[model samples]
Target: MPHRTYLTTPIYYASGAPHIGHAYTTILADALARFARQSGDDVLFLTGTDEHGPKIEEEAARRGVEPIELCDEMAARFRSAWERLDIGFDRFIRTTEDEHKAVVRAFVQRLHDRGHLYAGSYEGWYCVHEERYWTEKDLGPDNTCPDCGRPVRRIEEENWFFRMSTFQDALVAHIRDHPDWIVPEVRRNEVLGFLEKPLGDLSISRPRSRVQWGIPLPFDDDHVIYVWVDALVNYLTASGAVDPSLGPEAPGFEDPTGSWWPADLHIMGKDILTTHAVYWPTLLMGAGVPLPRHLLAHGWWVVGETKMSKSLGNVIDPLQLQEQYGTDAVRWYLLREMPTGSDASYTPERFLVRYEELANVLGNLAQRALSMIVRYRDGVVPEGDAGGLDDAVSTTLDAVAAALGDYRLHAALAAAMDLAREANGYVEAREPWAQAKDPARAGDLDDTLATLARVLGVLAALFHPVCPERSAELARRLGLSGVQTLQEARTDAPGGRTVERGDPLFPRVDV
Candidate 1:
């Protein structure tokens, strides 16, 4: 059986529209999934909208519409944006789905039965925007929510709480035991620092009177499960683990054989590190469900020295960029510009720089190689020894694999780009055009064209995950139905196949 890799992006909040930040995360996940599939791994990639929360309710009221209506509109927008960007997610889950609600109720009921939940009276600062409670120390100096720096409200009411504190020590031990459980050393250190403080019990429910737009607790309809809890269960809900209709004694929770539970990777922004690293693992432990293997917390996309935010009007619309520069260009700029685990600043100058790199390097090489093949070899790949680029291709493939193993997306892209540059240099050194003009060097010309064709084959695979559309076009030009894996391309003899030279894969863009 092929190895299975299950990956997920934190479902985007439906209270707002999709932005470049959302695109960045989904694009990264999509690239990883595509690469995994190409490498003979079964991949399950999940992405969707977080449709239930106090923020949604308030926004609906402000717009004079039902909450579900708002969620419907925003969810559609997200779906459309992702489709436009060519994101190939396996499942686009929504929190409002009947199946998801069922799983949430079942999971919560198990926690209650396991004595991890209790009824309690709570009073603290609550941020409507973030839908989270903040203690005195967690608030800003001006008594605002620390996370969003927004004014918070004080609400004292009866609610149910999770015994999150009980698992604090265990969580710490797990983090210490597996130093790589949380990625990007900085984010891991951040979680550990947060844990230095005593872990407090989490308020897991809100009274219906206070919040009417969340999943009702299975134990009590008067109180609904908090939005974060409802949202986090989405991964499990999509994993096909623990069918709610089968009751709590089912084997699905203990054995995830037929399901994709215990997800291999959970990808999200650094802002939500605590929820995934701390809240989620403890919740799984409470319900006797296996925890995900890894959590990758990536940095945000900042603009003007501030994180991109709708309120600040700094959000870049990825759809617009795709419209102007093509889907692959947008995806390339994002993956190439941002180093994994670190924040990246967006600027038109930088965008054009990355775009030019593609057009001048990969695109130019593709154009030159195929055009030369057509001019000298009648649109057919020449029969020659392609061993000239063998060592370089092997080295590049190894570097790409190693970079991807570490989840360094930018590094992987750099390695592929380096191979393109190397191939271009090879074309310069070999001088296929000069050889074609010399009757005495006919065999040398064939070797050069054949070596270039082989390198193009390898490139089509290396670039496919990041820029599927253009890579497919390049493969079609090379007379292949689609892109092949690096392994397949390494042994592929490109000689009898007919080639068609065409326009540049990435056309020059005027900034």
Candidate 2:
């Protein structure tokens, strides 16, 4: 059976337009999913909008539109942005979907039946901006919500609370026993430290009289489920945990048990670690659902020393970037430049620098090498004597494979580029232009052209996942057929076919 891998980004809250931060997370998830597919894994990638919340309702009211109408409009924007970026998600689940609602209700009801949920009066400082109730200590120095930087209002409302405090010790123990489940040691330490403090019962439901834009509670008619509770269920909802067989729509969808019980990874932002690492697992345990295998929390994106925010007027529109520089260029710069699990600044200058380095340096190498082959060898791939080439090319290929296998994508790309650099150096050293003048040394020209074609073939294959369109064009120009797996491309073929020249991989950008 093929190995199964499930990856997800937090369902983005649809309170505003999709920003660069949202695009960053989904892009990272997309890259991982692409890598897994290249590695021959059966993968399911999930991303969507978190449409039901007080924030959505408030925004709707301000616009004199119904909450659902607001959600519908904003959700479409999110979908369009993702499609433009080529996210390649298996399913874009909206929280308002019937399947999702049913799953959330069933899970919450199970928790209630198991005595993990109870009626309570929640009196706390609520942040309409955050759609969460914050405790006194959670406030900032000026008594404002830390996330939104706005004064929170103290409100007392009847609601159902999940007994999150009941499983604090268990969660701590789980983290202790499975340290590898969380990527980056610092993130794991942070989760452990948070759990070391007093745990609170999470407010899981809000009174419908106050907020009607959420999933209605199964046990009560006048209350709706909290947004976080409804939102977190998307993980299981997309995984076929509810209504087994994935609601009768998925092919070969079986009851998610045994091998499919727990998710392989939950890719989310560091801001939501508390929810994913702590509340999500505890809630699952309460409902007798399987805990996820891993939760990899990544840091936020900062722009010019400030976090990207709509209110701050520093939000980078992903569509603009895609429009200016093609989707693959945007995708390549993000994964190639940013070290996973760390924050990176987004700037036009930085993007331009990386694009030129990659497109001109790495991309130009393939173009030049293939052009030479077509010019000299009549568009036929020349054969290479494996014993004649330098050992450096083989060494670089090995290093690239090792980095890719270890999930060090930046390092992998670097290694692949190093091969391109090596090929360029070989061309310079061989002086193919000088050798072509003498008909007596025609064999030498054949050898030089053949070596260049072989190396370009390998580079094209390795680059396919990063800059897919450019790589395919490069592969075609090199007279290669079909998608060449990394393994096959790395090997030197003695009877290789001809090379064909094509358009430049990356067209020059104005800005």
Candidate 3:
């Protein structure tokens, strides 16, 4: 049976504009999803908008529009951006959707009935910008929000709280027991360190008068489900797995039919690690549903020398990038630039550096080989033995598989680029163009072209996850319609099919 894989990006907050941070997280999740699918997994990729809470209500009121209207507009922007980026997401959930609200209600009610929830009055520093309450120790000396460095207003209210403290020990043990539960040793350590500290009970609901644009609680109409609770439940609702009426075996959440319980991974920006790594798992555990297999938190995308934020007037609109460079170019740059769980700078220079890799390296290699094939062999793919090219292809495939196994996306991409470099070296050394000029060297020329085609075929398959459109085109030109997985890439065996030369895979961008 194919391995079952389910992954998600945190449903983005719809309060502010869609920035590059949102794009980066969503794109990364898309790439990982595509990789799993190409690797022969049954994958579900989920992303969506978090359209509940004070921020949305405030923003909508400010804009003189209904909350749903505001959500609709912003959600469309997000969808358009993802579409332009060629993100092949399986589901795009919205927190305001009835399906999602129903699931959130059901899940929260289960937790409440099971004694995991309680009504309480609270008073503390509340970051209205973040819609989260913080204790005195968490606030900066300036009394600014620790999260975004903005001023926070003090607020007092009665709210429903989740028993987050009860799961501290269990969560720590789980993290220790399953080291892969949170990706990259650094992030895992961060979560464990957090667990070492005392965990306060989580506020799980907001009074409706305070935040009128959210899902109302099943038992308490006067209060709505917390935005975190409503948003996090999306991963479950988006799966299309729940019957809404059927309750699973309390502890196991068993889906013998494999209908999407127990997510394989959730990919999000590092800022929300605690929410995902801590609250999400405990929430599931409290409700007797199995925890997700992994939570992968990736770093931020900052502009030159500083983090990109709307307030800073330095946010890079992803659409502008897509308009300047094509979709595949932007997608390739994003995936190839960032090391797993590490911050990456998105400056013009850095963008060009990645563009060069596409235009000067992979694209250049593809154009040269195909053009030469057409000129010499009349576009018929030449035949050769499992020469050095096979070893190179095998080595490259192994490297990509190994790198991706540890969630090293940058390393996986680097391995593919290395394969391109090896192919370029082989072509330069052999001088297949010179060999084509001599009648006696005809056999050598054919073998050399054949070797190039084989290597290129493997690359096309290998890069299918990162650059699907270009890779699929290359595969077709190389006569590899059926080759999809890395395993298939190794044995593509190009020989008899007719090849065609096309325009450049990636054109040079005018800087």
**Best by lDDT, which number?**
1
lDDT (Cα, tens digit) per residue for candidate 3, span 207-280: 88778888898889999988888888888887666656553322224342446767888998888998999999
* lDDT tens per residue, model 2, 1-511: 7789898899998888887778878887887787678768899998998989789999999999998898899889999898898888888989999888987887787788789988989888999887888989899877799888988888999989999999998888888999777876788999888887899999999899889889999889789999998999889888875673233232212336633447888888888888999889899878766688888777777897998887788888878888888888887887777776778888889999888967787778877876777777777766645333447667876787676554566777777777777777888898888887888877888888877776776777777777776777777776677557666766757346766677677877787
What local distance difference test score does each model get?
0.92, 0.80, 0.84
- Please identify which of the two predictions, 1 or 3, would achieve the higher lDDT against the true structure: 1
Best by TM-score: 1
lDDT (C-alpha) at residue 134 in model 1 = 84
* lDDT leaderboard ranking: 1, 3, 2
lDDT (C-alpha) at residue 8 in model 2:
89
- What C-alpha RMSD separates each model from the true structure? 1.1, 3.1, 1.9
Compared with the true structure, model 2 gives a TM-score of 0.92
Please give, for residues 405-474, the per-residue lDDT of candidate 1 as tens digits: 8799999999999999999999999998899989999999899998999899999999999999999999
C-alpha TM-scores of all predictions: 0.98, 0.92, 0.96
The candidate 3 region of ten consecutive residues with least summed lDDT is: 247-256
Shift of residue 471 alpha carbon in model 3, Å? 1.6
